[model samples]
Target: MALVACLAVALPAHAVNQDDLLPAEKAFAAQVSRSGDKLQLTLDVAPGYYLYRDRIAISTTPADLAGKPVLPAAQEKADPYFGKQFIYHGKQSIVIPLAAGAPADFQLNVRLQGCAEAGVCYPPYTHKLKVSAAGGKTESKLDNWLGGAATAGKSPAGNSELAAKGWLTTLGTFLLAGLGMAFTACMYPLLPIVSSLIAGQGATLTRGRGFLLSLLYVQGLALTYTAVGVVAGLTGSLLTVWLQQPAVVLTASALMVVFALSMFDLFTIQLPNALQSRLAESSNQLSGGKALTVFLMGAMSALIVGPCVAPPLALALGYIGSTGDALLGGAALYAMALGLGLPLILIGTFGGHVLPRAGNWMKVVKSGFGVVMLGLAIWMATPFLPASLVMLLWAALLIGAAVFLGAFDTLSTASKPGARLGKALGLLLFLLGGAQLVGLLSGADNPRYPLKLIAASSAEGAASHPFQPISSIAELDAKLAEAKSAGKPLLLDFYADWCVACKEMESEVFPQPLVAAKMGQFVLLRADVTANSDAHQALLKRFGLFGPPGIILFGADGKEAQRVVGFTPAAAFASQLGQVAH
Candidate 1:
């Protein structure tokens, strides 16, 4: 009884107090701005709670003096947090930028969320802030300071406004730029020289409607890019006004982590190629038929280039939203698109005559890209997670992607069905081997259990049921006590809803008949840490657990037998349980 009391509920609320929760009396001032326009508003956050990621939702409800406005892209930036751990703090401020021509007295509504450490999370919060623009020495001084960092007045003029000779030259320059960027990203910088080596055939873009149409299509790309830039400029001003210096570092690092994973395909979910092909073909067919089609093409291009838009684009959007300069926001996005797509346009026009066709070596280049991508994915997953878990995920994705790409290549070739099928399987082996190189980085399953499922199975010389969710620490202690009084072994599980591995165990290992049959020999107790249960909180403190999905075994004497921090297969868990039970 004494042992149980010390390990179980000894933790009190005052043990490791977080930040103090302020009373409702405290208030803070908020600012709203769009481009050169600015508004000062008051914001009052509830005591004991803090604003977190994606929690702030900005709206232009009261209508700025200029009119109801849409915040631009490129101006928004993510707010930062101090700790790597997933704890929420209690204070935050959001900056709003004003558009260049926004009116003097603009109004907007703000909605946010608040959280505290007492397991008492608050409901969503809302506020209506009224801001009046400043037009004096202060505005002038601020403009002078911001002129160097802002992107307003930076975009090139529209084609309609350029002289004939200048327009043609500009078009040529942009086309070449788009083509060059495309080629660079393709990673086949030397493709032109090897055009003749692929099946002894040289492909060329002939001078005709197809060529002319391609150029026209690119104009749509340019316009869309400009539109995105305007959006960026508008939001950039808003962020510039509202962004707090304290949260910047934390926000940047968290976003960087997410971006890095997305780039390396660690947790990415891409659409099927068939969907992509149909969309591209439909857009091409609709060229010049409708304005909407052109807009769709621009959207499609944005999606295609999304992977390459990373840190810079994210930062730009954050800045724009935080600020509120629609014009400047548009400029930044246009610049980015121009930088990314300029080479594609250039290659389509002048270089089509001298360029080489696609080749078999393109496959090699693709494979190399895959290797680099996989390596980065592994690196990104290494920071806060276990090496073996990262390797397993990496290995699975590599194997799956290799199989997919191999089959795609074989099917794309104009070969016999039988030959294609055979080629796919063979090429799949190559991709698999290439992908397995990541295994050199990490992933060795525990030898004793061999299942990586976190626990042992009866067949593996252990007697334990597969993983199951336990409801509370009190329930777990009761089971242990009862088991000891009856001279029986006990198995205890501590799991949470947010822990992905726990779900995996419940679905994969627990329902197995073999593990279920062996369950009758021991007293089983499940502690579910999913909700903010007081008992679960006590259990968390008892085990000094930073996170969830914990497993513990107790012998007949009611002492802690053993514990595992993460997922262990049934066989491994069973072995540990069996040892302690005997």
Candidate 2:
């Protein structure tokens, strides 16, 4: 009896509960309905469960009765089991195209696999439905419990399915993209503003108070962003275009200049005495109004500070404008803002403890922030500034920063360790500044690199492959006709100045000798969507492309051979070209 009791105590807690695991039917319920010669399969997924978008398969009994199933856009998730994949939670819908003169009845088979949030994955499940058609009306043999039947000549499932697919995908993409944008040059300036707000909480600052202030600030940003996106969607105008106007750019640059001056202690902008007294009183009483200042600042930052355009932002705006669905658009924008604020929140919470409280070092940190603000101001004015002038401004900034870092100062034996570190950084900056000055003199337009020497060396040997720019569907069709007449394959590249991936391809991938050599075989054409005009949008729509950095290849027979989306490395792209050539 003692041994039995000991064994019982030592044994694992309890046998896995089979009943707790969700059955295939309970986890995912499928419904088949038909509308206007198209069959729609809608899946009502249970909460805490998801189905892989790519794992879904649909076929017909007669084989030729239906074409392949067209899956709706699905939310992207970084799954532990499957790396990066698209999945659908809540509900999803897929449309299958039917062939002409279809039989009155056919068997539709669907095979799918899914998993519960509890980490239990179910095996592939297949469901067969007898689909009957008569007088443009259709019904499934399965019971209506799974939404299998639809009212004749009417679709019970309206645009909700389409909205679901778009919203889910948009939310996922914007959230991830925003996180990446948080670390970019456009968003970096806001970090100092957040840090300063937390630092202003004084010596008694606590983590809880810091978090509250940060949350309020982020909420304000998110709300403003959502509002702007919705308004843009309703108006059918791209806010980024207006924001990037020369006048607006100059005004924003001037505002940043003022902020930078304030940080440098050149002057201070303070509220009136009465307003200060009220704020002090509110802070003393621990009123919510104490955080309102930061909130307003966050809103201003969202609207005026960073107006940079990106592919995700453009895609979202375009979708919202086309669909006029403010709810989903707002949700996507809100998620993006949350992602953008994540880094700021982390910095605000932990920086209070890590950063030096009050010292000479604090002044240095403020001055450093001032320099960054100045750089940001210059960057905002780039559109208005001449290319040469921009390079000169960059050179001046780098050289001035180098001088501040003790590049010109002689370090004595008694110099602090910081002085040594500063000198090293200064030397590096000085070299970079020198390189920029040289590039500026040589009229090299690339601000990121001093490429004049390299360009001159490679000019003779470099392949001279030029791309004919096309902005509209008409132009693209004409170009395709010309290519076909010439008996040459064609490569269409979608590019945008605001797209980082496009720039990466231009600078890193396209410049490769192997890639350039292979490109000589095709007629290269480019559609620059930087303007995002009606024609540009039409071109993108014609190609079924969401945004720039998309490439399409057409064979000599005038048929689209392959399409490439997003960024591809040089080696991979070269291999793809080789295969296409063969």
Candidate 3:
């Protein structure tokens, strides 16, 4: 019994599943395909396998192609043995720039290195191909990064998936994606965020002045996406990954709280009179034109809030990783950033004409934004706070706002239209807040659907049948094997308490009866990557994901059939499951 117990305990601590490890070639495969002047490097990487970004090298015989081969962005993985490394997964395309006056058939050599996420690595190997209109002669050479003969030349920096599509087309594509983000985020959901930021100016903002400040603000966002992105890409790390850290998140939240208090007029945010005058003179600033201040705020906010993951973002990341060209990558990302700011330009430049006359009304606006700032601060902190604490905070904010709006004030026929509207709005807020408070008492963790948990008996508002937990590659493999044996499809959800999107899926998507019924066709597994330990990082990197809130589906055949990143609403996820389950 002692021996058995000891073995059992030790097995989990150092578990390695050989069954999950694929043959090196099956794990990662590479080939070269040509399309007119555009020669392409196509890579088909199997699920649970990845190729190293630095490990993929290409050099043509006689001379380089038009330029370097372009591959997609890679996720940074910190290996116990190899430390920090960049890797890629899934079907990826690399644009091989075709040079002028190049022969139709030429010799092209490619080198690749890959590893199994199940605690194994394959030494680097090289392959040589003869380029032709029909097909090329293929030859293999076993080599490592240290082998100088076959492995030579660096992969050029360019966007992946969209590579060789022409620079103008690529930029245009990202610009359109940016416009989509603007309408979805900047135009609506983030209007208040931007409004509150500008309201802190305290003085009347003429349309021109508003345009200038807003333009500066958008430039700040551009600068961050360029500088921060370049650094993170070159280093094989992600800026969002760092910003999500507990210390950084808490600090940013605290700063927002201070900014909120400043807007409340409890304290001013200006420097000492003498110093302010001196600095103003030196900088040639107008009395109320705090251009530098707003610019810095814009930069800071971009860093704290972070951009959503999009295909263009992934391509830009790939560009940064594959090519070390900061200038071109910066330009491409800056274009996208401008696209993100496009809608804001209209709001700032034209929307200011409708502002209330600049006096007491301005003060009211500032105070209102103060409340918004406080809410924003709480939103930032929610990921790190306990579920109970987060619910309490939201309830407090909502109830407080409701009371200030005069929910309890009795209204009469003589009450003004504005007064009646205020009371009605206040009443709505009060009811919502009351429900949220009650939901908190009923053991609800989701603020979005607080009362839904009251119907749940065991866990309340959260996922009733929480995902079967898996922490490491070995455990994931074991679960996959178990599901395969039972002839069941599998759904592995990458989740973290810090991920608001994941919570949305858990509360809003998974709880739906239709979605739940569809999910029943598969074995449900959840990887709580909240701690982000080395093992957790390994599990995430296995599938080439940057962070949590990703879903991977495996058919009964045990091959990956579908992948959904970010939030997927119930109806959509249900439809997806129906297609895969059959």
Candidate 4:
């Protein structure tokens, strides 16, 4: 089997004889290979464990033989197991491509950790795998059987091949992890606490410490959420393997209904206040170390978040199960957890002291949490809920949450601190509202083939570059100028590192040899807006975009021809290209 590999740590990679020795053997490996003409690397994953994707640090050095490994086009594959990213399981692998003139021998130093089913996590391990290649070959085999060869086909890989690469490359996106961290850190609910920490707390949290803690907390939550997403992603992945698994889809649909209903508390089983208070007292009495307590928290929190996590979770699990990158699926969970917990932890650690001297704010926070819960409900119901009806219900739920929480009454009675805090929170909410509005406006206004004409030119003997992603109007003009002069059709792909749909296109549609061949016909140009380079930003501004993965075509005359936004299948894309190129 041609197992592409990347460099891992260099600890004693011998087979484990668990019965002997103080310093146990640490197993590690990396995968490196070529896709078409590009060299790439996929980090090998140990079974029943995973390595942190974010923790992976590329060396600034280049290989002597190939020069450097080009990073793959990163994209996001839908993961039902987790809402956000891919999770990996079993022997996860990343394809590392080598550039021309890379060294024959080189090392990749990696730091990673692994965990077990029983919740027994192993210590962090390190290793380096030696990589050597004689030239680009179709059949390349790399092997270093540490835990013996993985029981072939027993455990599914977390993500599909495309998902593996897409998830990594898409890191060029506005990092939801980062955005979530900022939002949670500065949420209105936490503002009072934050101000108190800054003013009165003996040991205040510095922005650096807070940011780092936010990162760790978010990472932890993301890991946890990724575990959930892995399950969901694997389910979505199976859609391909089994044609959307109707039974599974129906089950997910039913569960989503329940999630929505529960979030709105439509089927409340009210308990007496005395009983509720006793339960709360008991919960508080239990030490944090108690597994049962944690499990209970997870279960209760999940119930409230069912509407929020399930839709994404189910999709992620299906995706992961199908694609086979459970580690990324796992990582997705960590990312989600990070999103959910970072703010809370920061508030508790740094601003816990400053929370209003009165418990009144608790009610407000609870109400805010309730609103989020309802939002989750609507989101969960969306898969089964008719889009129109879903919107109506979502609006109703929002109104109901506000009214039921007596937000107006609180607003009326709010004192200076309370009013100021509310205003700040409202500002935060306004920002979120603006973001959603922008998404709505752009989504509704986007038209297919908005660019009426496209053109291109190319050099007589320039190495045929595959289709390039274009993010700016200027780049389009430049490529058009070149194509016009050279008399070649221009192929432009507008992409962002963060788009989930873009990822789907890459993982499922772009890699087919036939698709690759057709794509190579034109003078390829890529406009990547993931990092928001000045040029890409200009294009986004011109196009009125709040998000990514817009594909456009150009004719020999160097004018925009047709554009397709979001993920397009290989056949569809090819057909479109055929029309434009001709």
lDDT of 4 at 70: 33
Which number leads on lDDT?
2
Candidate 3 CA-lDDT value: 0.62
Query: Per-residue CA lDDT of candidate 3, range 191-261, in tens?
Result: 55456556556567777877887888788877888785566446543443454358976886777677667
Judge candidate 1 at residue 392 and give its lDDT: 59
The regions of model 1 sitting more than 4 angstroms off are 1-227, 233-353, 357-475, 485-488, 496-501, 509-522, 529-533, 545-547, 566-582
Task: Order the candidate numbers by TM-score, best to worst.
Answer: 2, 3, 1, 4
Taking all chains together, each candidate's TM-score versus the true structure is 0.34, 0.40, 0.40, 0.30
lDDT of 2 by residue, 99-168 (tens): 9988777888877766554433444556666676642323334331222333222122222233434556
Task: Report the C-alpha displacement of residue 167, candidate 3, in angstroms.
Answer: 16
lDDT per residue for candidate 4 within 202-277, as digits (tens), equals: 3544655554443433343344465665664455434433523345445555555554454344553234568556
Lowest summed lDDT window (length 10), candidate 4: 1-10
- Stretches of candidate 4 off by over 4 Å are 1-254, 264-324, 332-582
- Lowest lDDT sum, 10 consecutive residues, model 3, at 2-11
Error of 2 at 431 (Å): 3.2
- Candidate 3 lands at a TM-score of 0.40
Q: Model 4 Cα RMSD, Å?
A: 20.0
